[model samples]
Target chain A: MATAPQLPTTRPLWARSPFYFNSTAHLLRIGRGKANNLQELLEALRLCPDSSIFRHTFQTLEEHHFIKEGFSNDFSHWAFAACNEVELAERLAIIDVREFTSIATLRDRLVLIIEEYLQKNPRAATRTAMEPFYLMDSDLVVVPTPYVARNLEEFADGLHKISIHSIYYHFIDARLRLKLNNNDFSIWLEKELDLAQAADRINRIDIYTSTLEGVRQNILKIIEIELATPDSAGPD
Target chain B: MKDKNPDRKTAVEEKNAEKNSKARDPKQQQEPATPAGQAAPQELAVPAAPSGTRERRFRQTDLPARVIERRKHPRISMEQPLPPAPPCLDDYVSIIGQPELDEIRFLARRLRGKTVKMVNSTAVGGGVAEILNRLIPLMNELEVPTRWDVITGGNDFYEVTKGFHNALHGGEYNLTQQIKDIFMSYSEQTRQRMEFTEDLFIIHDPQPVGLVHSKSQERGKWIWRCHMDLSNAHQGVWDFLKPMIEQYDAAVFSAPAFACQLPIPQYLFYPSIDPLSEKNRELPEEYINKVCDDFGIDRSRPVITQISRFDRLKDPVGVIEAYKLVKKYVDCQLVLAGGGATDDPEGAVVLQEVIEAAGDDPDVIILNLPPWSALEINALQRASTVIVQKSLKEGFGLTVTEGLWKEKPVVAGAVGGIPMQIIHKLTGVLVHSVEGCAYQIRYLLTHPEFATQLGKNGKEHAKENFLITVNLKRWLVLFQILLGMAKPNATI
Candidate 1:
């Protein structure tokens, strides 16, 4: 139910947006709490000229905890952000551990992770990390309306529940669970792809995985085209 | 007819004889197990008199050993008359034109005196029932003696079949061993009751697929007409049905994409919409306006609508989310109107979620019509600026065809037979996500000329590809092939 922030029309004072990645304790020094995107969060903490507005907006998680001070600005290195952002990916990876790595390495890693995290909950491994952007028109900071210092505990529980039970999320989970419980995912993938040797090359599945193994090459083509464009540019 | 298969003859004869000797008396001829068989019987053999206070319906009578399977199940042994369509096949001339009518009549010449029968689960309420209501009658008019038979099962049997339906369309299901027994045993009983075959016994979908087990008694051909997406059927269920499906002389799927690996020759045919049906016939503009007024839908604003039975797979909630997105941009009113089918029990639950999602949004209207509201359905389609069929998975969306027949632009899911109908931007738009649905609806509303042109193209496409006349032609050719009058590899 977490909504992405819709930017105001005119240049505003304080711009606050929710950070969407599952943040662990090691990466606590990331967001002031609320942030638009990772780049904005990193900019607010240690990289920006003014960091006070971010500190004020990204307030206590419930009572004590504030947004992480600063550690690694490297988390927003475009790739993960371009996909499900940080918090969302961490939350998702908590269920399907294959998500933690890059797409290129998913096939090899997915089977191993499914074996390890089948019914286990490494909950603390995916602690809450939000990076919201604050709206500031130079002098006065503008507060976004739906801004309540969201409970970190509640958010974490929501992510956990979503990963487990939400229809779209549970689909892959159910498939993965079948794999872990003596069901050969590779053999299933073989019939799914109508492949003779797909079971040999890949024993795991990506979320975008199709019955057609040949289509994986097509995704690479998209990545190539996507990389050619400038950061700000989007698909036409 | 023997390929030196005499070694198997003794075994086949024994099985056939065993089936021929059933527990029923001659007057109680068992009905063929239709997928959409009628639920309410005209006169049932109720208890002679009430003896004592009943705690519940069950534990009241001498309950069967499989009490849940037999008693708790939905009513199975009922019969409904074929809905009235064209009394004479000749009436289609003005609609389909003379050459097409003549063409169908010419094609029907070889099918005379040959028998064809349809086996489905229900005799009322779903698309299969609706189509056979008209198609069977029309075939009879063409001098082919075609019959429609429905199978009976209690409520438990339907619940299991509904699960299989969802699972075949890529939805998850928890099909326990008990439900599997319920499915197989009931199918066995129905098969025993209606084991007789004609020149062609066309079994529709998985409900009566077990009837193929009676192929030993087959004096002629049997065709398995699957009306759902089997591309992602649950592996276990598929494994169970695959052998039975393979035994058929041939199989028919609604789209080429639904085809799966099998040694038997498989044919693809789209489910057709009847042009003269109450739901598809062109309506007067004023009547359309009255439905809008009755539903409290605003005629002034751009109207976006989706009319589907309230089933989870139909993705009514997803449609609501898409409307919310479109509502952010366009000043429009969204209407989601649908009813229930006897086969599906999840309709009420899904309807509640749809209502909750639309939640106090005055612009969003939800209407739950009865199963017989064909005219109201017609009016809604006519009144709509755009019609959306945002299903997560579909078999062949005849509702999509119905909307197209009315020359209304449709936004539908790219799944199932929808892609065969909507050629992306050509006939209509096919959406993969809720956002895509909203974006397409917004685009069409903004660009009326393009939407109108798409609708025109959609109408022409449905006429050529998805009408009963075209379907009739195909069935005739298949009949010819079965009768050895046409080449096995022949195409219409």
Candidate 2:
């Protein structure tokens, strides 16, 4: 292989780095302690001895190899969500959809990981958060497929050829639901900075990209910038 | 710009005698027609009241008693010290996290002696004033010398600016050349009298947006902080204000989406609450009980509360409608808590409508609180079973953040920054209509476990996201970036 495989490694800068959280679950990890209740959390905050406070969020996406029932066998994907289509999630413990909808919930589930799960599926990694977790490799990987192409143009062309393949539609609904849930922060972005206009764009925008995947990628990229955008210094 | 001498104070008092005579003349005042098209209120001929009098709490500022009094005996421009810096932000480690602490430290070190001045119209009312009260102190404590100054204007000036405020918030307001002339004249007056030279001068909202024209007459890097939602700004008004806004070095907005077609680098700035402030602080049982008794609220009952200024935009009437729907399905009390801002003329009118909407419903408790009632505000939030912020349009709903801080599950309108706080079914619920609000409230009250979890999650979210420490970090990063000490694309 010309490129090394993308694997999960701890984020290097996270260490000796100030703690940042994506959600409330990360807030509970101060003093290497978890808040048992809201009162306890408030008390801890009031007494929190650290002089500097900052917010930073971390996510780890790892590739996993799983076999299909027939035809094309092995495939790899990077997900914070549990996989079920290829029975990979079933191979591990089943994730109740109700319980694992948020970043906080996923962090909690990762905390209670069984030793067997890590051993059997070394690639079945959960994103570690808040506390000083090890730095992980972020190099992205693509799993080998029988439909692999020769180049970027060839790969895009090959994907178009398989546009109607069942593989693409199998988990489309569930993936779309998760994206809708987690990717809607554009609406709440504050300041006299209102997203009313951007929201209008979301509704009115026509697909100008070459493919649905291309449009999804563009949307995701914009979301990354919007999410990374800092809060306004303007009035509430 | 004002130079004070003890001897000049005596002369200034003499000038007041002359000015006071003119202040009493109705012909001397220029009354701008109300933008909402209501009949102009009569200007009171009485001498403006003493600064701290009980009557100072009156609603309209068309001719602020204080402003009239000040014009009568115009004193040297005095630089008032803001509230002392609250406890060091470093003390908030477990809450704000460490990343914020490091950034503040870095920015403070970079801009050690630089002075930043903030100017706004009203000093007491509105979100801009409320946020500055807390933010100035925090910024000062972080070792950034910051000052907050209010622009001096009269009935004609503030009324005109109020029209601008309404127009920016999407109301159909037309700025006649007469109003534009008054705005520029007053802004020029403020520009001449006040010191506009600082490392950074933040002109807030529309009231002070005209102050940028003063930049030509002064020396300072100016950033206009617009806190109103202008997504639906009336184009006529926007066109009139665009050139004036373009005079600033940069513009800051509360949300990225509110960024218009401005030709300046715009930074997103979110407002935050001081965790240690009276409004968000943990209250003793004694204080909570006393407040509950005072308000006739039974803490044991399911209390659904909304704390916001009694503005039409806050939709207090809509809240009443939602409360009535919830009351039909389940037994619960709705507490509509808020007060009038000194600068807003429309509060009293909207408040009357809210009262009329409430009628004789004993279950609906409307406590119209006054300014400086932070403890009572805190107690009401603590006593609440669920907090609601159902705004029709919001810049960023601070009340919702406050509710979430108190560990109360909030049901807020799915508008503006409410979605940032509620996160729909995760921290709290976001609703679009009265029925939806009622449905969510009923769902929460009937399901205590779900509500409790939501509240817990909300408190954690507020702790991480909406606290002042997080805001300070972002602000410091802004300072560093502007000063060329940090990456322009820095994520604080």
Candidate 3:
């Protein structure tokens, strides 16, 4: 096999700035927008606040972090559980949140998916849900934790020590908040440490297939492998 | 961009200019500006006398006979000094880790100066009183300055409110004008007697809900905490209470289904139990055995338990019916342990029915424990093989949370807040009927390994979501939002 070029271990000064670990606790409030049928749901999605879009999609990962089965978002869950719309539910469930950055785009995608489904099955538009879907939004109360990492060794240690909530905040939530295609950890690793290969490896981690704890274990494994590289320095 | 409504924009500009001119005056500048949507403290028409001064005025020799007659009721009792809190913030660090504790402290720091006052119908019985008793002390320990007040009323008042409670839980009530008058009369007396000095007032349940009539923008924000299931509330009772409920700055419900479509923003708050409290604290094997012996519950045989008040809503008769069905398949004993709340006048009647339903069944035991029998209840729960909470209509079903916290397989009714706690065979099994409850009990008794796993998952679920620490965090966050310290919908 041909040998790949060795990457440099040294990093720029900006990349060495410590990553402060933060976590969020949400204060959930019921939004004014509610829907009883598919047509009404489409209207509510069009007019509902961006935070509601964030809540049903991105925040659902944290809320239902334990469940390994079923649809990922509340909309799909409601569609299947309440409306008995299996085909539409599956379609909505497949709209992966990772594809979009801004909540506006995510909302548009949801609207588009529902619209397309309604076009295909016109009767589905008039089908009433067993229970009304009440739109809810959460206010994120972010608090910095004691864990901070200035280097890869400390980053692995911090990841091991921090709560699963912190992991969700940095890995999943930061994607929408930062309006970037990548998560906070990947962004920092590539921007500051000049570790684009390592960042890309992390960015490729399948978030949908695993729990938050599972994600943490995978990240720790990757960091351990990186730390074993010949030129990699131990914690500074 | 140019203003779309030029005249309206100009009028707003002129008003702002006038306000600014007034602000430029030295006298106007000397006074602190009240935030928009908030009234100045002085604008409260009620006298802001210290409680002691108010008491002194009541003792004046020249007081009128009408005043003295009105004082006979003494509706609002001052906050009784609490005993020392058993589980401080540091104590919870063992159950929930240090990071969770630190987060609670951080949220509390934002609400350091604000005062919280919790008002309910009773001071010693029921879930609301028990939570307030522990919560107030712990919040004060966190330096949040919390107090609790119990509103006292005559027996007629309680009877009427009990009817209101049942009606709110979707039971039928006549809801006559007499009932309305009794509710408002007691509420008015409570309003007159109590001092509304706290920065935040939490009016719990419908009994004290009418006190929102005293809400002034100059005073602190008022929140109506509806701890009942109002999804199918009687329209007449709801209409009577709607205006007062709408007057609140916000409303909080135990579950999403418990909320009505009110104009004010509604938040979902799950009621919690104190792990360090006698009702939930870990008990020794010897103590558990003694409790079982005391109740005549056979330890060798599988013991199923349900702990709740002797209220009709709890469905103790339904529990007995389920136990009889399970008895056919398994040689198990059922322990139905509970006491009565002071405000629930119908408990005695329901207790009679439960006793009759369980008549002469050697395998079934019913213990009418007192309110202070926390240790005994904890031991009984710890000794049980499985726990069940078969409520026909429930208010959050704290008993189910208590059972799950003890790491016991729980079979609860899929109503109110019970479903939120029991995640349908994931944490614990949620049953809809006596037959389903019996079926699950028999299944769990037969499948020991799966039962143990459910128990373990149930404990983890309770630890994560239903512990007192999480409830404290929710309150602190709500305080932050109401006090303008944090935005209601802001993201990190």
Reference contacts preserved by each model: 0.00, 0.00, 0.33
What clash pairs does model 3 have? A15-A192
Q: Which portions of model 1 show Cα errors greater than 4 Å? A: A1-236, B1-87, B153-192, B195-197, B216-218, B324-329, B340-353, B488-492
Candidate 2 or 3, higher lDDT? Answer: 3
DockQ of each: 0.01, 0.02, 0.31
Clash counts per candidate, in order, are 51, 35, 1
- Which lDDT tens digits does candidate 1 get at residues B18-82? 33333123343343232333442233222221122121232232323343232223122122222
Instruction: Name the top lDDT candidate.
Output: 3
TM for candidate 2 is 0.55
lDDT scores in order: 0.57, 0.55, 0.76
Q: For residues B178-241, write the lDDT of model 3, one tens digit per residue.
A: 8888899999998998888889999999999998888877879999998888889999999999
Number of backbone clashes in candidate 1: 51
Best by DockQ: 3
What is the C-alpha RMSD, rounded to one decimal, of candidate 2?
22.0
* Residue-level lDDT for B410 in candidate 2: 93
Off by over 4 Å in 2: A1-236, B1-99, B213-220, B341-361, B488-492
